[model samples]
Target: MSEQFERLSRLPLRDDLRGKHPYGAPQLDVPILLNVNENTYGVPDDVRQAIVEAVSREVVGLNRYPDREFTELRTNLARYLGHGLTPENLWAANGSNEVLQHLLQAFGGPGRSAIGFPPTYSMYPLLASSTGTRYIAGRGNEKFDLNAEDAAREVRQSGANLVFLCSPNNPSGSALGLDVVEAVYEASEDAQAIVIVDEAYAEFAHSGTVSALSLLAGRERLVVSRTMSKAFAMAGTRLGYLASAPEVADALRLVRLPYHLSAITQAAANAALTHSDLLLANVENIKVQRDRIVAGLLQLGLTPVPSDANFVLFGGLDDPHRIWQGLLDGGVLIRDVGIPGHLRVTAGTETETTVFLETLGALLERAVS
Candidate 1:
């Protein structure tokens, strides 16, 4: 297997992809899994039972194709989002990544470019590359924050046909202000670009952090994408959706394959939506633990970025990879997100959080001694 995989890489591949690595986080089996920003709490028993019932109902209908447009699932998603949206204003796929790929396919291609403000979600650039779109690197400040002015400047300068902004950004966890979203949308007017706000982590954001969905009222060029993978505790279900103008949703239809969503997937997500409140009950608890992580990292004299998501990114490490390995050796798994001198850990359950903090504290103490 290893020899064949190595040979495959050496085969004639896309020149741009020749030396590039695939996107992945270490999937180690550990006592405490604080990587990947998954909800530590599993699906509630009530929601699980409801989903099972929903899926069972669709079993006999397996011979038929899922709704080509997934009407019922879209309506349920619209109801969950609650911005006076209808199925016309929604689109969904196996994951937000696919939803995003649809957008790029419709608006971006050879000779057109897309821009993403980094240390953002790594997939934005990868998506651009895979779709035969030029990837333009946009800048964020030293603290990895992108203000309205800088964002507007990058959009205008890059002449980007698509722009991606990840709020409660991964590896940083800071939420982008709505003002930034508005500014970037306005800036992209000349380029006729589509702006995508990847809010996969929005449910875990601190209160008062507004979603870009609020800005979709008049902005036909704006898209706010979300997923069930994070706070919804439905990562394995793989349902992601986006909200935009009805016209934008129509554009996505031209690019998406027919019957892209499986009947089982639609049933599972719809049933989960019916029990939305119960599924989201753990959000506040996760927020509490996220705050605890920030405070605990501070007490250890590390520089932890203030986060609006379930994970915390911290710096001031002499060797981030070494510390990551040390934590893994202690049976706690976290992410070393290629950021020099920094590491990120998800806000796990209380006991898991305790194990992570205790293990790291001991390591820090040992280093100091």
Candidate 2:
């Protein structure tokens, strides 16, 4: 712990929060950053101009709090997501992280339990903890893919109040099939659990991969969360939202702070959505790079998990951290998820992807020698 955090920790803290670390990916300064699955290809100039213009229009409104309901913003998001959703079916916050926090605040609390399949998003358990919700660590197969039967069984057994399923799951980049979603929903019926399908990377999934959104028609207990951060390249904006029944969105209103979204945030995200096509233009390029990384790793004799998201998780490393540091020394940074002997790297531009692959190949060559 840092000296500042140590001093802070000395003060009385929540008993459960004591000794717990914050969720973070290493924010390193390097020539190539593949650590977080960020769209290295930034906002296009035209879209940036639109966002600036949109925020300018909101400047006078800075005197007033933003729309507590975020009406127009939700409409834009609903239209973007399609599947015949409307503002009534939507709720958004600073990021998917906050959106999730809101869900926990509303439906998850002391005595209730939540569960997630790992190597998944780290925030699920953290969100549960912060809400005083008991968190259960669920499992997946060796490849990190949770089949329908296995996933449903865990839900039936855990009897959790909230369950998170990350489609095109983080770190491993494997997506959940709709069959799994349906099965888990059926199994959770007896327990009356809320099944949350986190689609943070949904936009980057390969074509023909059906989204959990398709399964949301009559499933009142189901929520499909999405974000502008990943494929939309708006990490700086921190806008995340979800689609569910109107009742679910109504429940969030009880817990969300009034006017939580600033005028500027609403403006920026609304502007980005205005040019959704332009903003999402790079998704194809990123997918190309993601596949390139997988192929490159396979050729290097490493085992890469087949990915549908914009990053690849690979294994077969003798010393994952050693290779991680070596890559950083070469000015490339990737993620060493706590999974032993495995590392994850975001797919960047063609050149950045080439640098990462070439760097890893050189490191492997050195290890052999």
Candidate 3:
């Protein structure tokens, strides 16, 4: 008989991701990059100094493991979140990405299902599949609005164990209103499923948008995942925290490896918290830039989605890929969302935005001619 290993090797991998890269658009070495939605600013000098100071004191044993519980970091995070954080109610991961994975490990797996709304973050389904969970998508309304009723119906019918919602949703830059989010939360409550509001872009949204934390009061099953990647400008540091009820937080901790965060990373994140004022200042700048860019796009005859986040999405170009390439060749790089004729551009510095607009103008002129 043929070797049993031969059959195992031939078996197909997960069907959900027949052919897909885990992430979109590899980072290229280009000037004026407005892709990936990173904060266009760098960590403030004061914050950098704090990082240097935190690690400057040499410990007795360099080989000793970091605090597995990350008590100090958790405390700082709790303080940062203002109301929802407690030592018992929060956890940190290598990144929000890892936090999401841990969630999948805990609540998702073979035979269980997770629901996401698309044209949202691409990672949700990918994470679900990697953990052997079935992934279901509820298409958004024509204007990319969250159809919470439809999503709730899907969850009820599919018995999904988790529901992921991204506020100021990725790619589209449209935020779900409070009523809609609350409706979904209420719907998921009976299913005993978790509702995760990924607030990666929350800091940039204008005030009064519904933060998941607002609804978290007394709600044990809701989780809000946040990252230092955007407003804090700490993406490379890979520090993210989740706010939830102590029990849910404990569940996440159980699934994560001990000491998942590095001493240096924890130090960096701690420093980031202290200088949040500086970060908020940058956020204000980005908001102004975002508005200016949106106005410019509208004036150019492109229809930009109303955005409360740090980026904007626009359509009406004949071929978005060609326009993206043209902008790239012109030394301005923006993301070509796979959605037909749409592109997402992150807010950058005034100078970079100026160059981007000029380049985009020339490209549109060429296309029109």
Candidate 4:
């Protein structure tokens, strides 16, 4: 048990959560923040103005509740995704984390189990635990690469009722090909699993990286979840949604709180989607920095995993903590991610990237000579 468990011993805390810690990264007040994989660029002027106007309009109607279904927001999100997706095929929540939570509540419970590959999103297991679902830690092949056959085999072995596939997966920064998704779905036939493709970082994927949305045509068991937090430059919006069979939305309705999405949130998200073109312009710049970080790491004699997301995970640090502390002391903050000799850094603005690379290079030089 954790030290906190003793402090809360008098209360009726859940036994499963005895020693658990909440999921979070440092929110330090530093000059440069390349951790947390957030879009470092602030919202564009036009988009910011649009969100302001939309939210202002909702203030007058604060006395009334938000749309129970968030209909307009769903329509806008559907239009933004555009893989023949309609509002009826969409669902929304406070964030993608909650979207996953709702799915767990609707489909996962005491008798159900959920599975995901390791070194993937940390939230998958946490979300599973929150909903009383068993979390199965699956595996990846060499260098954290998972192929169709290997993934399918694991799913069959786990017999999980729900499966989370984090595309352009977190920390590793690689996406799963559609074949893997297809094979996993096929393998899950006997278990009747609900396969979720977490495309939270899809907008940042490299050239020709396919998305699971293309495979959702007739698959009632597949869901493609997305968020406005990454390339959209709307992390403050806290909006996450999914495209699935219409019946899935109906299932969620039974468990979600009334007016879970507020009027202000719907307005702001709808406005942001209308200006998605301007918002996505920032994604191109971030991708440039991502590539640059990979190349810079190579020049520094470090190994940067190939990435389709806005961050890079690099290895070869002699003492990971020393380097992490060195960077922090230099006024730049990145993620250690608890991996030995490996750390993850989000691709920030050009200036931020340059400083990070330069700062890290200096530290490496000092460590050697």
Give the range of the ten consecutive residues with the poorest summed lDDT in model 2.
Answer: 137-146
User: What is the per-residue lDDT of model 4 for residues 77-133, given as tens digits with 9 covering 90 to 100?
Assistant: 889889999999999999899999999999998999999987889899999989899
What is each predicted model's overall lDDT from 0 to 1? Answer: 0.91, 0.93, 0.83, 0.92
lDDT of 1 by residue, 1-369 (tens): 577668878788888776676788888778888889899899999999999999999999999999998999989999999888888999999999899999999999899999988888889889999999999888865577889999999899999999998998887999999999999999999999999999999999887888888899989999999999998999999999999999999998899988899999999999999999999999999999889999999999999999999999999999888789999999999998888899999999999889889999999999889
Off by over 4 Å in 1: 1-6
Alpha carbon deviation, residue 118, candidate 1 (Å): 0.7
Ranking by lDDT: 2, 4, 1, 3
TM, every model: 0.97, 0.98, 0.93, 0.98
Prediction 1 global C-alpha lDDT: 0.91
Which stretches of candidate 3 lie above 4 Å from their native place? 1-20, 58-61
Error of 3 at 353 (Å): 1.0
Model 1 steric clash pairs: none
What TM-score does prediction 4 earn? 0.98
Q: Which residue pairs of candidate 3 clash?
A: none
